[model samples]
Target: MELDLFRWRFVHWQFMLTRPSNYTAGNIGGSVSGVKIAFLGNGSYAFTVTGNSNPDGSIYNSEEAITSQTTGRLYGAIFVRHWDSYITPQRQTIFYGSLKKDGSQYALSKVVNVLKGTNLESPVPQFGSTDNFDVSSSGIAFVSKDPVLQPAIFTKINAYFVPLTDFTVASPPSPIQIQTSGFNGQATSPVFSPDGKQLAFLRRKSVQYESDKLQLFVLTDVAEPNSTINALPTADQKGAWDRSPSSVFWSPDGKTLYLTAEEHGRVALFTLEPPSVTANSSSLPKKVFYDGAISSAYPLSNGDVFISGSNLVDNSIYFHYDSTSGKSNVLSSNAKNGTVFGLSRSQISEIWYPGAAEGTQIHAWVVKPSNFSATQKYPLAYLIHGGPQGSWEDSWSTRWNPAVFAEQGYVVVAPNPTGSTGYGQGLTDAIQGEWGGLPYEDIVLGFQYIEENLDYVDTSRAVELGASYGGYMTNWIQGHDLGRKFKALVTHDGVFSMVSQLASEEQWFPDHDLEGPYWKNPSSWLKWDPSAHTANWSTPHLIIHNELDYRLTIAEGLAAFNVLQQRGIESEFLSFPNENHWVLKPENSLLWHTAVLDFINKHVGLPTYSEQSSYAKQLRSEAWQNRKGDLGRKV
Candidate 1:
């Protein structure tokens, strides 16, 4: 049996198993020769394809071909049936079974009705490695919507266990419900301990709040039908500790659980040992590794661990961590030569400075030009990340890339301020409802610190750029005292008015992040409203808005541009009528970069190659011709 890599997303790898001899032998009958098995991300379902391999070793090319195949299967399928009035809601039935070849077709064996309900108020099952389910030799542990909760104001998710034996029998036994009493929030990523006595999972209070942090929990007596869940005490619960924790691995002794968590500005490794009930000892989680952001980790039988992570200067790289030496050795990387984005001489470094709040520290990434020199002053491009809850990770991004700015002879500084993840939960939670308070202060102070400390930086030639939440910050900065700090500003798909943003597609973001709905607290809505301070705007601005940006809505960008035009500020509006919140298409992205770089060059001096390079000349000519054509048509 050979397992071939099918698809990879984030840290999860989906595989397809193939039996080479079975295809040619035609043991399964008909045109279909082999069984192709595929597993979903969260193991919610497993699909099988029973089809013939072509000359090129590919199968199931079309819908007709798939239907004509010898067999097909869908495990753990949920069926919904609607009845009565349209508002009465629908009934759901979950089915689980194995597929077997049955006379030129396929049949489900040991078919089991795992769950059935009318008006089941539960979250849709998340089929991935991080979100919902895991399977072991003993049983299958999964996170499912709690059917008991009604009205579904906030869907409550709970952990469930079904014995492996139940699937083999004609009638499956009722799944054992692992009660999460104290922690009645959402639960996910259930991983059984090596001894099978305890199960570890991540719990969040509510789904309404985007900033809600996931805490680690270990359920004792997991074998019992009713087990008690205890929150594992960690050294830094306040810091977004264990925020988005996944890929749980247990030590060989079953005494310690190792997992990857976001801390400060990186996704590092941490370990937690369940406290003893008799001794009442403190069993806090401790940081075991601090190299960079770890995407995935797997423990080996020999006590060593394999990890895939990236630092401030590199992309995804594989490494082996030695348990005894406490050292990590590089195994492989896409850019093993230490070059990134084909820029061999560029450098990246993490810079820490005193945060806006006294005694607090802020972190940011600084990308220097490939030909950086201390004697000459360089223009700075201060990049802000979206997701006031998101971070400037030690990873590479094609969109909003700092390296591109660096390649253009500009030093880039991306700060992970308050509310950014990977830091402790406390810092992440501090920015909620105070969007323009601590987080804004952090960004301003971060720039001030960089300006004061970095003598090679030309603060007067700086340009501030951001998208999404970062765009919101850029809007806020344009109206605040910090607006005078930068020579030019760029806001893309950002929120302009807090109250108007309530009309966004995602209602939960404003409901929780902004404290509540506009009706509930009208005054709070005006606190971060950039429209209210348009009188103070004086900076040259470039506004980018997309038609399909339902998250922040195109209206928000329109409102900001209206203010810029009304205030007579030197501004330009770049609208992507065909794109969404993000400009993803190749041609559109190229146009975006060209326009943005042109705007920056217009304010700050152009790079040395801008006038000489044929590509730059062609891009400028194309832009000019398009603008002239638009003006001519209007006349």
Candidate 2:
């Protein structure tokens, strides 16, 4: 083993691209779309379908989990994004084919078939570009771009309709012109109406505008060339970005449209009625229902809408008002376990996690401070979750707190933005490869949203911190911008150098390789590489990690500390030799939290030198050995 280790060091870079055979569930797209979940496999796969059959009379080959119901077709990304780049069979094309009863398969029966374009000879690119595809009642519609950088403007909404004979050659009739002149803003949250005749989408607000508003636009005859479209006004006359209109779906009746309004730091479900043109050719919108606490809502074809609430304990339980029975039961009440509110009395408002963004209905929890008072201004600690895929569920977290942060005179805003799961495939796929891009924007915008709309926050005194991926983001944010916004930062076991992470021959190296061969695309890796711009980092930071964490490894933390020292930055490093990916044990957690409080106090203008001195000394000795290049040296 020692000899092998030595050999690995000599040629560590060789194993940089040796990733797992294929992307794991981690690489799978986010939230489940329709009721018919799909999966991708290398021709060998198995699944079960209930009360469903393919056109070929075979039981559907289901692999991925879809969350919609009987009447509607679901959509999911075929490819997924990896660390610094995109992956393919991209989310749009990589779909699993379900089998029909008589042993026949649908168009997407096999993973290979999904990857093969009309021309089955050439394999698809494993990197670059992000797209979402949908097959509506009318036909198949795909949202793609000629150049990824050019706003993901909706190019063409396709319609493929043919009789049973032409099913084999089902091709699009023609391209629909949604935004012909090109939407001034980027195209996001595109959804087709029930009839597939019209398309509804969110036009993101520009960066210069300092607003995250989205406006709802309708493209009628979307599958036809030179179609008519209109950006409809809401009854409130408010812009969409603030409360960006999303999760847009036409009701089963098709008379009303359901949309989520996420703005003013609140997510509400709103129902809209399209305008009727008068002699002046103007239309009016009427509001139906608004539920602010329900920030993210999805309407199911079963006449049920699953809305994620801000309450910790019951954050997400399917909800519906039985118009017929006048009775409602929270769907899956059995799934709720007081996991979100372990502390009992804490009033959690929302929750956040690793992959979510602002304006995104991420899973999060907010607890009012103990002995709270409206007159008091509180501090904040923006807590982040790990996993770039892990969720900050209603479950108890050993990490940051709603009550604890609030008790510490801080308000916490945890948002699960673009990359978070439990939402659906489209939202999850959006964050792939866009790690630093969309995720960062979501975090910043979420923070800004809280400061603007929430009254209890003390923005100037807020701090940001996280572990693993969260730590990586902390380091990324600190290096990118620190205009005294975050009073302090704590990053635990974060990857500081993409170059080192790529070169290391560890268990993680293979999984990390899922990003694609760095040799093939250095630009993608650089885009999310925190170490690339460490030279610009100036924020006081606390580096924490477990000595035995193979996932991130101790060397990564040391590298970050060394870089900070080299730059004369105010920082400290902490480690738990007995811990792993997380500081799990109770004693370790207490110590960890104590150290964190001490660090925050010192950095947030309160001194805790006496309490932190001993730990500081211990870290200095350990850090100094590495600093002086003494440990790894063979004297």
Candidate 3:
């Protein structure tokens, strides 16, 4: 298990990766001719792991049972069930074989399924993996998702191409789709380059916006999948860069391409080079490092790179960089070398202000409170983030962490409103079809810029939390006028209607941000629905909802906790039923951060987990890390 297996990041491999049993829910990539494993497809059948080279005997199990759904009655679709099981036609195939070295024990011969009866399927649902497929000694580029549309109204995906066969041949090799030099929609992170004849991917043309803008295809020769496609800046090429990256790595010598994007609110690191193999630049992609949020980039073979990042009071760091003095050197950190998660970087800061359009500009993140003080005032928290096109960056987060609510004496903030995402894409497409109009006026101007310019924030002792579309803007500011200024509100797994979000299975995200299918556009989603402004309900909410989320499903948190319990307001619902749409176990994230910090510490007066403190009861501990460099990883 000490596999350097011949350094892959800098490319120098041979092959031997069969040590991670129990199948593989993702990532195992190897292909000078074998070893490719990736798991999970179950709803009925799923298994794919091969390594052919057979010296003889023992293990090789590839179970696939889909005798064509023999009637269990389930039809009319847009994804039978998505972000948490159900869709079962038993997809996810890829099997290949050979690795028979007998004596010291080894076996897995003949195998097969390389898209067996080709309609193609792969690690592409609920976000695919093993970077959606690669494998080299000549062929295997993968990237399914478009098994002929309908998976919630389209986002293409395609990319195919098979060609290395040897399962004693007979059926397998019609794959070939890779012709995306015309920038198709959704294709996704293919990789391949370090001499697999080239193949780097990331595409997007919006089959109805999934936060479009990825475009960065590279495919020369690829040994053949409709080969030669040198497209780099051609959409009327001349200055193509409005950025939207988030994936694309390779540069150890495939002539450059680093990517990663999400700029202003930070996620940086760029590099590219495809203006027909540039030697003088102009195909854009060149921002190489600009302070934190990196999330991986390896490269190195002299043109150094390493990287690993985090911020907002640090949870990890490790730099290196030095592409000949472009600067970055800080080789290790968990905030600081000797480990002092008592957090720092002066308790994080960065604001920006004003945005709801006209002269736009919004981005927030503030934190403070590792026992912070300048004549203490604290108690604000705020926090609303959940990909209404995501962005409350300067990283570090293990679910709603603003330094664990600034260690609970509060002062958190977090905004990035106007549909976040490293700012700039016209304020992230100004929340497409204007979600509740201008990200709810950039979150009521980030709570009127912390109730009119912070003074150690208090906002009448605020609270407000959020999940999924920040739980539909905590059920759209509880009912608006920003729920008469929150003293409480949480909402995980959000969205409570717009025609019960057609029980979500990703209908191209409410058919492009609630502008199309609610029975063919129900007034663009009952015009910014929070159950259509429930006669401005009195807020004291806290409805968590999970039951395998299915993207805003558990009946949108039981219709906003049965309309705040039949309008008598003061709500509270919290379900889990084995979680989904996040609440990822660890004793259910310490019973969801002790039921969202004890219902926002009993509505902001503070101290509730039995009158807190003991580092807020070591965030529900097993002495298993809660402070100091925070819960290991999951930023």
Best by lDDT: 3
Better of 1 and 3 by TM-score: 1
Best by TM-score: 1
What's the lDDT of the predicted structure labeled candidate 2? 0.50
Better of 1 and 3 by lDDT: 3
Ranking by TM-score: 1, 2, 3
In candidate 2, stretches whose alpha carbon ends up further than 4 angstroms from where it belongs are 1-82, 85-131, 147-178, 204-213, 233-242, 275-296, 300-304, 310-315, 321-404, 407-488, 491-540, 544-560, 563-570, 573-635
Tell me the whole-model lDDT of each prediction, alpha carbons only: 0.66, 0.50, 0.69
lDDT of 1 by residue, 89-129 (tens): 22222333443345533343433334432222112422233
lDDT of 3 by residue, 264-301 (tens): 77788988774343332355777879776888777887
Query: Mind giving the per-residue lDDT tens digits that candidate 2 earns over 68-145?
Result: 566443335322222223332223232222322222222222211222232111111222121233334443333433
- RMSD (Å) of each candidate, 1 decimal: 8.4, 15.4, 24.1
Candidate with better TM-score, 1 vs 2: 1
